[model samples]
Target: MTLRRLPDLTWEDVGALDLDRTVAILPVGATEAHGPHLPLDTDVTIAAAMAEAGGRRLSAHGLEAVLLDALQYTPAAFAASFPGTISIGGATLAALLTDLAASVQRAGIPTLAIANAHFDPTHLRALHTAVSAINAGGVLRAVFPDVTRRPWGGRLTAEFRSGACHAGQYEGSIVLARSPERVRGEVMRELDDNPVSLSAAIAEGAQDFVAAGGPQAYFGSPAAATAEEGHATIETLGDILSEAVIDALGTETWPRTKEQT
Candidate 1:
């Protein structure tokens, strides 16, 4: 059967799909400053692209998957001091997530996965809380955060550690890869220093990275970012996410409890 994108699918069409077999992917991102070089919508753009790629792959495998509209407005506590940054409080973000998950459950989609591109603490907490609620409600079987888990997580994590993960090389590369025109290469050259190291601070549950000594509200070497690396990262992340979705669909526990549905 030909797969239908969620945006294109009518309410009747969604209602017709086997609810038990359908999967919904929600792309979660934040509107935050990524230095002067990148657009404020970087997170949403990347998350949406990744989710679309994953949905296509799942559909190719005969499992139905659709990309939901992104949850773009989110917590940007780290970049709160920066202009053009739009962030919400933790409680607000959690409420949004909970409502979205509940809507998906009511729509009859058995599996729901949130594809997150931003790493804000508040955003993470909200997402986790939503997943917990969905799981408790017995409407969702599995929820995969950071779709990089199964196949390419190790590689991505390694790259992230190698000065590519932060707003520097890795994120810049993705922005360039997804939309070269949106990147300001010259501006990136000026903010080339690593912002702050979170290895120690994160353990203590700090909210803002800038407050922890990352003055520029960025990290890693922006000069090192390349369109090639961005493309490679996206492709790798997409592959891993696809495999994860397929695996989740194949599991018996997925869409775990049928009592509520």
Candidate 2:
């Protein structure tokens, strides 16, 4: 069966689905500079890829899931100094998520899974608040956050943990794997020596990294990235997210009871 995409799904199409077995997957990503090798929309691109992969996997099992257009360009305060880094601030991001959740709920989707690739603390917090509010009001039946923490997250590991987690070998490899035509090999070579250690920088909260502080805006060694690793990461994430969707949908309940006032 062909899976439905959010942008292409019509009201009639939505009405035909088994509501209990369907999930709405929202791909949330950031538009920031990913060094020299990857595109500015690396986070958004990866999130979309993950969502699509997960949706396909779920669809094969008689469970339906659709990938929503990624909410690209999140609040990246730490990387704001870098060129091509576009942010909307914490308040705006929170409001956007809330509105999106509200719309999904109003459309009768019982479960909403936010597949986010960007690991900004503020964005995560905003997502949590938005999802919590929607679920608490009984508008959304359930919400799943940080789908990456699942077992499938392990597949992203490589010689460089920074690459797998941020704009490094992992992301560059995935981009090359999924969309090789877009990878800029020349730029990757030019910025090969300016890789940043995301964990250390964030832990220290210091603005003294070579990428963010110096010439480049990347945090990992894209030189180590390969198309093979990217494919494996995508496949693993797909499996994890598919299972998550099934579990989430199964746990969904209806007829919310009113609290005693």
Candidate 3:
């Protein structure tokens, strides 16, 4: 079955679906500064690509996949100083996620899977809080494969694992693969590698991009990004999301065990 975009389907179309075997994939991202070379929506692009890929994979596994519109506004305190960065309250984001899951549950969808690329601490915390609330509700299952954590973190490219990957080769490559036109080719080629790890900075009590040693709102190697690497990394991200969803479902059986009586 082809992966469906939720917005494109009418109420009748959605009502006709066997929601028991369906998964709604939400692409979570942030509208924040990446670098001089990349667009502010870079995270959104990557998240959408991951969701698309993951949705296809879920379809292959016999579950109907529905792609929800991207979640673009989130807490981005780390990059708040940047000109185009838009930051929201962590509590607000958490509440939104919780409510979203409740609505999905009421619509009869069994699972909501997140395809996230933004890694701001505030944003991560919000996601954690919302997922906890969603699961506690006991109706909707929220599947979040947090790439910043262990196991999932280990599966990405070296640049991603380095913790200095904000708008660096890791993210730049994915943007290059998914939306090359959004990249500033001239500036990207001249950028020097900023290997200071943002993760390490946060651990050491640093706040915001400048304090993390990324004065230009960037980190790691940007000049080294390639579409090939981006594609590969997206595939890895997709696999991570798909596997998480499957695991959360508690079985490989996508087919419903019994008819809905």
Candidate 4:
């Protein structure tokens, strides 16, 4: 019933785990620009929070959740112009994901769940490719709850759904909740609203953050962010990840209950 950090455990501890009931949760993020208010590793912080919360939920449901070391370097071309943004090739990310999955499979873990917070187009495409490749190999099941689409996206806040939420309220709130010390509160409060939807701009052929209408590497309303809202959003993210993993396992061991929701 305890959630474990895989990196913190000894080889003996890992080897003794009931692998059949264990799910390794990988926190995937990007070292990219999130505006002047937030840190470059903003996505890394959010992904870690999601993974920890999801791992706790899985543990509550009688599953063994193992948290893996975060994958922080990812494709982040949109933020490439920013000073500290580290963008990698999408193919490199895909190959790394595949290799990680295969490594986990070899270590007796049957399921690998990704808790990803970065949503750059190239990064997302790489994730989809990696997930597909991992599943096709049949070595182990890889579950990715793509938060940008469908049911998952709908469950998030209005700012996030608006797609103008790079370093804005949506992401800023999470950073505030997880690492308040990193937020440049004075600058965040003075920033004007940039309601332009990055998604819509991308659809119109915009490539980077500037072309996407985020000259400051941000969009939406940053001043609107709150720690409470960030906590709520993190909880929702946890729900999305836990539900996806449970569904992927497809077992009747954990029955759904009204109270659980």
Candidate 5:
């Protein structure tokens, strides 16, 4: 079996898949503020690439998986103040995911896997809530490895924990890894480091980017980001993603057997 992209494949191609063993990966992202240097689709790019890597990992592990289109509009409460940052309401985001999950199940896909990159509190809550709703409906819930947790989180870079990684070294590095041209060299060189803990500010009732002490809508060492570190970060993210798929496959509830009454 090949690692296919759901959108690129024809209906006949999808029909040929072994539904019992196949899984659909749904990459989720938010078109939010990513500081001055990064684009609006930064989250989307990261999530989509990670999802593809995860799909490849599942294929390597002897299962079939495909990457689906990413959900771009997610809750962006923090970045919503910034111009060009588009955000959907939390409830709306949840409604969309719930509908997508149901749509996938009806297509005969055995299971739906969610791949995400955005770390906004509201965004995370919406994704989980949507998944919970789907799971409650008796549909096979997707595997969402909390990258913010141990093991996987530990696998990520140090800047991630500092909470100043928004468009900083952590994100900048991986963005460079994925697309070097997108990174502005002059901006990176001139930008001073802001090592403030965004989490701390948020704990103190900081809501938006400015309230978080980031007037420029950024934090951490953007200038220090290197392509080498970016590649390494991408690799680690891929490991986290693929591992989730493998682990989820072991516990899939697809082709659910009828309970013996």
Candidate 6:
């Protein structure tokens, strides 16, 4: 009865849940280098945590949250130089997402909510393409809050707004909050705040992190990241996901009688 992850559940386990109130929560991120101090699955970890928190929020509203397997392979052209970074072509990523969306539709899930932590330009484009393709099929639709935009973006940390948060304090802090043991504190202490905006560099035709003035594959102040901030950021991210999904589903108030699990 405590099951939240779809991949961990049997067919009958899912069937026992109220089908009408179930929502699929897909955590999307890239398998790429975060920095010397952070882990390669940093983005994936953040996405999964955010989605899980959103799932809990949904549960509080009397809905069943079905957590989908996190998609870790995403388009990471910019971080290609890192040893641990693995990236797929944008088209390949797009097709994969499109197929998944279609499968969700065929399975009778009217809506799929994606909680993405990686916001690579190519990845965003691919997601947009997949959403378009799925909507065109008229079966189901994929909704991504795209926290990079407006109001939601503003709600995040200032480092995120700077757009050079690759493995910096913003990211490192989140990892610290989730799993402090994984962080290499020595390396993190050695790294300082990289003020260069990788976003701006990319706009100026820099295709990779080195060209973006992040030669070490990191930006922003890793030394400044704290677990407190990391937890706060996760909470903010969860709010973004919850609001986006709720708005997309057209839920005006609490969907049903509150159900605690």
Candidate 4 stretches greater than 4 Å from native: 254-261
Which residue pairs of candidate 1 clash?
Answer: 141-255, 195-219
Preferred candidate (TM-score higher): 4 or 6: 4
Instruction: Report the poorest 10 consecutive residues by lDDT, candidate 1.
Output: 251-260
Residue-wise C-alpha lDDT for candidate 2, range 1-261, written one tens digit per residue:
456787897888888878766788888888877766678888888888888888887667666687777889787765677787888878788787778877877777777877778876677777777777777886575455464344444445643444324666778878888888888887775655444556566566654335334346666676777889888878866766766666655533322124211
Model 5 is weakest, by summed lDDT over 10 consecutive residues, at 252-261
lDDT tens string, model 5, 21-40?
A: 78898888888777788878
Off by over 4 Å in 1: 1-3, 147-152, 157-159, 162-164, 204-207, 251-261
lDDT winner: 4
- For residues 48-142, could you state the per-residue lDDT of candidate 6 as single tens digits? 98998888877767667889999999999989988989999889988998888877766667778899999789998888888788778876857
C-alpha lDDT (0 to 100) for residue 250 of candidate 2: 56
- Evaluate all candidate structures by whole-model CA lDDT and list the values in order: 0.73, 0.70, 0.92, 0.93, 0.80, 0.84
Give the root-mean-square deviation of each candidate in angstroms: 5.3, 6.4, 3.5, 1.4, 5.1, 2.5
**Which residues of candidate 3, in runs, are more than 4 Å off?**
255-261
For each candidate, give its TM-score against the true structure.
0.85, 0.85, 0.96, 0.97, 0.92, 0.94
Name model 5 segments beyond 4 Å from true: 251-261
The true-versus-predicted C-alpha distance at residue 32 of model 4, in Å, is 0.9
Local lDDT at 171 for model 5: 83
lDDT of 4 by residue, 156-254 (tens): 999999988888999999989999999999999999999999999988999999999999999999999999999999999999999999889885856
Q: Pick the TM-score winner.
A: 4
* Per-residue error (Å), model 5, residue 179: 1.4
Candidates 2 and 5, the one with greater lDDT? 5
- Over 17-81, each residue of candidate 1 has an lDDT whose tens digit, in order, gives 97777778888888988777888888888888777777776666556787788888998887888
